[model samples]
Target chain A: DVKVTQSSRYLVKRTGEKVFLECVQDMDHENMFWYRQDPGLGLRLIYFSYDVKMKEKGDIPEGYSVSREKKERFSLILESASTNQTSMYLCASTTAPTGRNTIYFGEGSWLTVV
Target chain B: AQSVTQPDIHITVSEGASLELRCNYSYGATPYLFWYVQSPGQGLQLLLKYFSGDTLVQGIKGFEAEFKRSQSSFNLRKPSVHWSDAAEYFCAVGEAGGGNKLTFGTGTQLKVEL
Candidate 1:
């Protein structure tokens, strides 16, 4: 079974503080993704990386950025955390692109900005 | 751009009752379809996916989904509902030809009554 790990399970930070959410996948998948899940809005893609050092912005990337310095790791960075940034963040990964590749997700990280 | 729609926001069913969750998609051509479930404070889990071949696909925990090209819908079904099955279900769509991005729906919250 594929496993995606998120370093932080829960965190609370003050406004204007910087936040980091780390994710790592064990299967050597080439594609990694970060998504923000809100109550009514569902899951919105934040950022994704197809290769090491290569990143692309997703639909809701306005207040977030991502780094993929290594193949098995992808990190989400919030320059300045705010109350609105308090939500659940999910990390997912999949093997090289294919018509039928299934993406696996980590347990998730709950961030609370106060 | 591909998109998904989950019409029902919340559904309640008694234990041992039949279950069906509706999902609709908008894409140019054939799109990769997937159904995912997320428990409270946890990451999303893949329930099933439809690429081609089989229109009706079986997934984990006695769940199944059927793809309909004419209606552009993939609806999830279960023969019997259990209280433990209560969770948030999401429907997602991805581009064909090995595209990496996936568009997700807002999600439906299921409540099973014992």
Candidate 2:
């Protein structure tokens, strides 16, 4: 079975602070994604990495950045955390660009900005 | 651009009752469809996916979905509902070719009553 692990399950940060969310996958998938899950908005992609150090902006990438220094790890960075950024963040990974490939998600990191 | 729509924002069902969640998609051609479930404080889990062939596809937790080309819909169904089945369900659509990005719906919140 594939396993995806998140660095933190819960986090709280003050406004204007920087935050980092880390994710690691044991499956060695080639594609990694970062998304924020919000009520009424569902899951909106923030960023995605197809390979090491290669990143692409998703639909909503305004206040977030991502890092993929290695194949098994992906990190989401918030330049300046704000109350609006408080939400559940999810990390997912997939093997490759296959039609049948399914993305497996980590447990998720809940962030609270005050 | 491809998009997905989940009509029901919230649904209430009694235990052992039938369940159905409506999902509609807007895409140019035959698109890849998927259904995911997210329990409270948990990440999204893929229930099932439909690439091609067999309109009706069985998924985990006794869930199933049907792809209708004419209606451009991929609706999820479950014969009997359980209290543990209460969660948020999301419908997503992706392009047929490789390197396709997934577009998710707003999601439907299911509430199982006693």
RMSD of each: 1.0, 1.0
Off by over 4 Å in 1: none
lDDT of 2 by residue, B1-114 (tens): 989999999999999999999999998888989999999888889999999999999999999999999999999999999999999999998778886488899999999999
Model 2 Cα lDDT, one tens digit per residue, A22-41: 99999989999998999999
Clashes of each: 0, 0
TM-score of each: 0.97, 0.97
Give the interface-residue alpha carbon RMSD of model 2.
1.5
The 10-residue segment of model 2 chain B with minimum total lDDT is: B94-103
The value of fnat for model 2 is 0.55
- Our tally of clashes for model 2 stands at 0
DockQ of each: 0.72, 0.67
Q: Candidate 1: which pairs clash?
A: none
Model 2 bad stretches (over 4 Å): none
Q: What is the lDDT of residue A44 in candidate 2?
A: 94
